[model samples]
Target: MKQKSTSPWAWVPTLYFAEGIPYVVVMTVSVIMYKRLGISNADIALYTSWLYLPWVIKFAWSPLVDILKTKRWWIVVMQLLIGAGLGGVALTIPVPDFFQYTLLFFWLLAFSSATHDIAADGFYMLDLDEHKQAYFIGIRSTFYRLAMITGQGLLIILAGFIESSTGLEPVEFSVTTQSTHTEWVVPQAKSVTTGGENQFVVTQADVVIGLNKLNKIQADSIKDWAHKQNLSNGFVIKEVQLEQAPGWWSSNVATPLKESLKERFGKEDKSAMFKGEVQGNIAAFGIRLAQMPEEGENVVLNLDRQSGAKDLSLVEGHRLTFNNQNWDQQAWVLVQADPKLDTAVSADFRGLSGNIPFAWSVTFFVLAILFVVFLIYHRFFLPRPAADKPVAESKNMLNEFVETFVSFFKKENFAIGLLFILVFRLGESQLVKLASPFLLDAREAGGLGLTTGDVGLIYGTIGIIFLTLGGIIGGYLASRNGLKYWIWWMTLAINLPNLTYVYLSYATPESMWIVACSVAVEQFGYGFGFTAYMLYLIYFSEGKSKTAHYAICSGLMALGMMIPGMISGWLQEIVGYQNFFIWVMICTIPGFLIIKFLKIDPTFGIKKQ
Candidate 1:
C-alpha cells in the first residue's frame, strides 16, 4: 500500500521559522545586547563573530547526519538541542560575568542551529516529491523570512521593550564647577556633593594651607613641613557617598586631574616636584567636589595666624563652612580649585546611570517557553517518514568525510567560485556587525542616538517588513527573468545601499522618519540581493551528493560573514563609524571583481511559463 503524504502547509512554515530563530538570535540579537551592555565595538565584533565558527565548519559534519540516524530523528533532536541552547543563553545573560558565560551558550546555539539546517533541508527533500517541493519552495522561503522578522525584528523589539521596563541605563554623569579666585594659588581644597549629600566630604574647618615666600621655601623645609602636617604621602580623598558609579569612574576621574596638572606644571615644575608626586597625587586625590553657589551663602575659608614663624606654623589654617540646606541636589563633582587660578575645572561622565539590571530574565524565560511550545508542536504534528538506510557504515564515516571535503574543491572554477562566495557579502558582514550599535550610540559618538525601543521600531519592525518584501520581489523577478540577468543588479543591491549608513553618520538626523527610511531601504536591498547569492549556491551544488555540496556552500557563506565581521569592531574603532562605513563600501570591490568570472546558466532560475 502507498503511504499517505503529509501536507507541506502543516509543517513547512514552522520548520523554516524554527530554523531562522536560533541563527538570528546568535548572529544578530547577541550583537545588539552586547552593544547595549557597553561592550566595546572591537570586543563585541571579535567575540560574537567567533560564534560563527560552527556554521562555517558545519559542512564538515553534514555527512554524519546522513550516515547516523534518519533525517526526521536528527531534525527533532537538533530542535530540542537548539531550544536548550537558547535557554542557556537567556539564563546566563544576567550573570555578573555574562559576556564569557553567555558566549558559551551562543556557541551551543550556533552549532545546533547549523545541524538543524542540514537535517531540516534533507528532510524536506525526503518528505516531498518534485512537484510539491517546487510548489512549496516559495512558501518555505517566506516563512524563513518571517523567522527573520521574529528573531531580528520582533524579538529585538521585545528586548528593547524589556530594556525600557527593566531600568537598565548606561553609567554616565557630568559636573560643571566654577570658582572665585582673585590670585593664582595652587589648588588647596575641594569637595564633591551628590544628591544633596557630601560625597567626598573634606573637613575644611581643620584643613590648613601653608604659604611661604618662594625664596624661603627650601626643599628640606617643604619635606619637613609635609611630615609635620600629617600629610602621609598626601591627603587621601575618599569617595564617601557614591549615588551612581559608572563602570569607568575610578579610571577616568583622575584623567582630567592629570591633564590639569600637566597643563599647569611645565617640564621645570615636574622636575621640582617630589619623585612620582604627580602619580601619587592622582592616586591619593582623584575625586572632584563641586558645590553649586547659593544666593546669600558664600562658602569662604578664613585663615588665622598661629603665634610666630618659629611655631611650626609657616602656613595659616582656615575653617571653611557652608550651609548644605540651601544647595540643590544635582550631580556636581569638584576637581582642582585655586584661590587664585584663572582656569575652571570641569568633569563630565557620559553613560552612567543606576545599576539596576534590566528585566532580561523575563524575555529569556518567555523565549524558553516559546521554544518548548515549538518542540511540543513539532513532535506531535511533524510526520515521521520511514527511515532511509544510513548512507555509510560507521567505519566508512572517515572516508565519506574526506570525499565530501575533497569533492567541493574539485568543482569547475572552484578557486574563483570560492573567492566569489567569500567576498560577496564582505561589506555587508561588517555593516551588520555595528548597525545596531551605530543606531543606539549617542549622536555625539557618531550614531543616531536612538533609544533601544526606537531601534526596535525602526530597524527590527519597520526595516524587516521591507526586507521581507524585497525578498519576495527578488524571488518573483528571478523567476520571471532568470538569475543570470539579475545577477549584476543583485550584486549592486547588496553593496550600494550601505550609503544609507554613510549618510546617517554624516547627517546625524534627529527625525525618526529619516532613520526608519534609511534602514528600510538598506534592508530591502539586502533581502533582494541575497536571492542571487542563494540561487548561486544552489547552482554550484547541483552535482553528485547535491545536499552535501549545498551544505559546503552554506559553510562557505558563514565563513564569509564570520571573518570580515570578526574585525569589524576594531576597524570601526580605528576609523569612527562614518569612515568605517566608507571602508565597507570600498571593500565591496572584490565582490564585484570576482563576480566577473562566475559561470551562471541563463535559464537556471526562470519559471516554466
Candidate 2:
C-alpha cells in the first residue's frame, strides 16, 4: 500500500492539544468542580486522587498498544471512547448520585486518556524522522500548553460565567461597623410567610454590627457553639433549623464514620482559636425563598464580597443550596468584623442563585463535543505511515516487556534513582490538590474565599504564564550551565517558594493581585525546579531499553503524586489550611534529603560546544 504523507503541521498540534485536555480535566478541573458542588474536601481529594491510578499503572498496558493494533487505530478509537466518557460525565452531573457516576466516567476518561497518550507518543516517533522529530518537539509542547490554558483557564472561566449569569438577579447588601456598643442580644424570631416562586427574600436589606469584642469566655462559648453547628464563630442571634433531616446515609453512615475519624485523628487546638487579644465581632442574617423550587431544580446562593472594607468580611454562608424541600427554611449568613476595627466601615456583598450542577454539566458537554471533533479530525487527517504498524512477533512481546523491566532494575544506583524520582515532589504532590480548594473555601475556614472565576483568572492564566516563563528560563540556564551545577538551586527554587502558600493561608488577603502574585511565585518555582526533575529522568533512563524505562519512571512520578494527594485533603480538614501549608513546607525536607544521594553527570543538559 502507498503510504499517505500529510503535513506534520496538520496533525501534531491538534494531536497534542487533544492529549493535554483530558489530563487537565481529569486531574485539575475535577477538584474545582467537586469543591463548588459542596463535596467535603476529604472526599474531593481522596476520590479525585484515585483518578491518577490509570496513569500510574499505564505502563502495564502500554505494551498492548504496540502488540495489537496500529498506533493510528489506537489513537482514533481512544478519542471516541474519551468523547463517550465525557458525555457520560455530563449526563450524570445533575443526578442525585452525580459524584459516584461522574467518578465512574472519570475513570473511563482517565484510562482512555492514558492509552491515548501511549499511542499518540508512539505514533509521533513512527510518523516523523529523527530530524523532524527534534524540530517539532517545541511545537508539540507549545500546543500541549495551549491545551492546558484552554482546559484550566478558558473552560473554568466559562463555567464561572455561567454560574454568575444563570441565576436570579443578584441581591446586593452592605454591612457597616459602628463604634457604639450594642448589647449582644438574640433577635426575636419573626413569623414565617411564603412568597411567590423563585423569589429570594432577605430578612434585612442591610445590617449594622457593633465593633465591641466579646469577652474571652463569651467568645469561646460562641466559637464552641458555632463549631458544633458547623457554622463560623459569630453571634447566632436567631437559630434556623432545617425543616427535614438529611438522608439516612448522611445521618446514619457518613456522619458516624466522620465523627469516629475526627475523634481519632482530628485534635483541635483551642488556643489557636483566640490568637489575638480581642475576638472579632460577628452577626448573622437570614435568607429564604418565597416559595419552593420546582421538582429536580436546586437554587444555589453564592455570596461574595463585591466592594467593601477588607476588615468587614463574610465569614460564613458563602454558599447555600435550596430545593423544594428546604426553600422556606432560613439560611444564615455570618459576617465578622476585624478585631482591630474601631471606626465605621462598610462592606458590600452580593448573592446569586445559580444552578451549580447545570454550569458544570454544560462545561463537560462542551468537552464531549470537543473530543468528538478531535476524533473526526484525526481520523481523516492523521497520516498513514508504513512504520506505524503493529509488532509482528506478538508472542515475544511479553518477554521483551519483562526484560525492559529487568534492565531498568539492574541499572547503576537503581534504588537511589527510584527514591529520587518518588520523593522529588513530595510537597508539591499535596499542594496541587488543596490549592484550589483553599482558594474556594470560606473565610472562616482560613481560605482566600475566592470565587471560581477569580481562581481561574489568578491560578490558571496568570500563574500558568509565570510557570511557563520559569520553565523556559530554567531550560536556558540548564543548557548553559548543565544540570549538576543548577540542581541544588533548582531544588531550592521549587521548595522555598512554597512559603507563599503559608503566607497566603495566614493572611488570606482579599486583594486579587496579592493572591495572583503569590500563586505566580509558587508556580514559577515549581516550573523552574521541575526542569531538573525531567532532566534527571532522561539521564536515569539512558542505555538499553531507555524508552521503556522512561515510561516506568513517569508512572512512578504519578504514583508519588497520587498517594500524597489522596491524604492532603484529610490532613487539611484536620489541621486547617493555615497549618496544612506549614506541613507542606516540612514535607519538602525529604525531597531535599533524597537529592544528596543522587549521582549525576556534570555535563548533562549542557549544549555540547
Best by lDDT: 2
* Candidate 2, superposed: residue stretches over 4 Å from native: 1-17, 31-46, 70-73, 94-99, 119-157, 160-168, 174-197, 205-279, 292-329, 337-357, 378-393, 411-416, 423-465, 476-525, 542-548, 558-609
Q: Pairing residues by index, what is the TM-score of model 1?
A: 0.55
Estimate the TM-score of every prediction: 0.55, 0.65
Q: Model 2, 288-331: lDDT tens per residue?
A: 77776789776767777777676777766776777776666566
Give candidate 1 regions above 4 Å deviation. Answer: 1-7, 21-53, 80-111, 124-389, 393-395, 434-456, 502-512, 569-582, 607-609
Candidate 1 global CA lDDT score: 0.64
- Lowest-sum lDDT 10-residue window in model 2: 229-238
lDDT of 2 at 434: 96
Candidate 1: worst-modelled 10 consecutive residues by lDDT: 278-287
True-structure lDDT of candidate 2: 0.78
What is the C-alpha lDDT profile of model 1 across 1-609, one tens digit per residue?
877767778899899988888888888888876755545567878898898788778787887877677777777888888878777877787687988887888888899899999888777766654334434555678898778767766775576455434322322223222332122223344444356633223322222222221222333344344333322212211123437765574468645554564455312322234322221000011222244445554332211222221112212111222234323221111122121112233333222111213444456667667778878888878877764445666657778767766877899989988888899999999999999999966555667756555676887679878887777777667777777888899999989999999999998987889889999999999988987887777777665445677788887888899888987885675457777888899998998888889988787766543
